[model samples]
Target chain A: DAGITQSPRYKITETGRQVTLMCHQTWSHSYMFWYRQDLGHGLRLIYYSAAADITDKGEVPDGYVVSRSKTENFPLTLESATRSQTSVYFCASSATGTNTEAFFGQGTRLTVV
Target chain B: GESVGLHLPTLSVQEGDNSIINCAYSNSASDYFIWYKQESGKGPQFIIDIRSNMDKRQGQRVTVLLNKTVKHLSLQIAATQPGDSAVYFCAPRQAGFQKLVFGTGTRLLVSP
Candidate 1:
């Protein structure tokens, strides 16, 4: 509705396959981020978009690609899914990049085999 | 290497008892801190937040205490209930960055 949403609540793909996870926010936030959550690692940022057509790498960006064509949509793509890439992915958005609140969507549980 | 960490991985408390979760941060430049509550299979939901300028901030049933000298933060829940059982995470927002470094998280188990 008015908050952020992630597509494909659960996904299972084979190794070497390409898959994309979608995120959309209705709040028109200026910042959107993708994070992967794993045991003992908490949440590691994969990529973040400050605005449309502007993106930057975070702590863990290898093997993952992200693009934001529009302000409301930020999608993460895995060119070649590996077993190590299997983890829960969360998408979040904030109105600004500094000192602002972030709203998260229901996570996407991806399993690569 | 700035990092946020939790003191306990899991905590068990009886219903109606007070619950406390502690977190340690390594960044003195962190100016803002937040606490989130996450249930099984769900994303983290914001609970409370405090700024570096303040030592304590209180909400309905929760309180956040920030000690800048030691770079420590804590979340105290008053009159814990069964619904309070969830994984609690502390995140500190580093100045000049959008990233909010999250803690390892503490699982609170409230037994009724």
Candidate 2:
């Protein structure tokens, strides 16, 4: 497909385990972002990358880690997944960070038990 | 403190009626705002956007109104259809910031 895609549409893991959600975009956008959606919180940005190898923390980036080595791929990793970390993750990309509309992926549903 | 919140959690309207979903933001300095529609098991898709400088912007069937004085944003859908049933979110972002903050979202149900 030519749009953004997220891998492992659904995942289940135990607490203290490490899990990663993958995101790939074919548009070659300059900005890629990771966001977690939970009940009552809507979508909170976990991390965002302005370009390859230039990632920054977002609103809720405490337990989540993200890296963008390539413009097409941005993966989010949970160092030590906790029960509270169970939420739906969405990956989005935009041509630029300012005033540009972002396109989102299908989303990854992660369940931590 | 960044907070964007929707006034209604759920809205039920007739298929031919005009639906309005309202959102309020705490940040008065936010210049950019966007409305997204998310169906079941899918990511949010952009519908319309309005900037702080503009009070209202219209799309194909959607209209977004921005009230910078009250920090209120609204999305109005004309002639609502069954396909319009989805969760709508309003996101606000300050200029020059990479982070986009989304609201809790309001579920719009169109009854035919």
Candidate 3:
């Protein structure tokens, strides 16, 4: 496929364990982002990368870590998963413009037990 | 993760009727706002966007209105259809920034 993709459309992990969610885009977009959707709170940005090797924190990035070593790949890791960390994670990519619309992948539903 | 139903604010409308969804933000630095539609089990798709400098922007069947004074934005759909039923979200971004922050979504249900 030519669009963005997310691994393990669904995942279940134990609390305090470590898990990493993978994101890949074929467009080689310059901007990639990770967001979590929960009840009452819409899609909140966890981390975003402007380009390769450049990442920044968003509104909620306390327990999440992101890395972007390659333009086509951006992975998010949960150092110590907690119950509160359970949510639907979405990965998106956009071209090199500030006004460019982002393209999102089918979310990964992560459940922490 | 497990998601509960009926938690989001919903707007129920009959087919052929006009629908309007509203969103509010408190960030004064937000320079651009966009409306997105998300179907079940799918990611959001952009509908329309309006910048802080503009008051209203119109698309094919959707219109976005931005009110910088009160920090309010709205998305209006003309002639609602069953296919238009989905969760609608408003995202705001600061100037010179690509990071978008979304607001709580409103689920639009169109009855045929």
Candidate 4:
């Protein structure tokens, strides 16, 4: 079952510390996305990459940064963690077509202390 | 900000009954809509999708209906089972945009 994987399934860090969540997909889908799930707010996009070295800001990119660097991997970094940024983060990818059925990774739950 | 949202926060249904989950979107330019089911402690799983050109599409025991005029989308599950319990989310994608704007989600509780 080589689909998508996320590292550090659960993490706890200090408010001012830096943390990075890693995402990798075997599909080489060409489009990868990072999203955060919060109560009442649903899933908010943090960042996405269309291809290698092509990244763009999403709806909630203020406290986070993302880079593609490689087509198979997309990593999200929290330069300075905050309590408000503590939420379950998910990574997704979709093929390049109309039936671009996006697939999601198991998600990483982060707790900012 | 205006976004894709669900009409209900939760829905309680019994097994063997029909379940209908509704979502509302404000993006009129959206051309593709999808339904995803997410279980506890896991990421969302793709269920089904319907394009703006079609009003209905069906799959194994699941059907997705889209109404462009009202900007509404609904997922209908037939003979619901306990395994069908999960948070359902609706996501819509605008033309030329690969990213999807997701709805708030509706939690479905299927009781046996």
TM-score, chain B, each candidate: 0.98, 0.98, 0.91, 0.97
The residue-by-residue lDDT of candidate 4 on A70-97, one tens digit each, is 8999999999999999999999999888
Q: Which stretches of candidate 3 lie over 4 Å from their true place?
A: B1-8
Worst 10 residues of 2 chain A by lDDT: A93-102
Off by over 4 Å in 1: none
Least accurate 10 contiguous residues by lDDT in model 1 chain A: A94-103
Give TM per candidate. 0.98, 0.97, 0.92, 0.98
True contacts kept of 4: 0.69
Q: Residues B1-81, candidate 2, lDDT per residue (tens digit)?
A: 679889999999999999999999998878889999999999999998877889999999899998898999999999999
lDDT tens readout by residue for model 1, A1-113:
68999999999999999999999999999999998999988888899988999999998999999999999999999999999999999999988745676789999999999
- Candidate 2 clash pair list: none
Q: i-RMS values of the candidates, in order?
A: 1.2, 1.1, 1.1, 0.8
In candidate 4, stretches whose alpha carbon ends up further than 4 angstroms from where it belongs are none
Fnat value of model 1: 0.51
What does candidate 4's lDDT look like per residue over B1-112, in tens digits? 3398788999999999999999999989888888999999999999999888999999999999998899999999999999999999999998788899888899999999
Residue-by-residue lDDT tens digits, candidate 3, B5-93: 22238999999999989887877887877788999999999888887889999999898888789778888999999999999988887
Clashing pairs in 3: none
Residue B59 lDDT, candidate 2, scale 0-100: 99
Docking class of 1: medium
Worst 10 residues of 4 chain B by lDDT: B1-10
Task: Identify the candidate with maximal lDDT.
Answer: 4
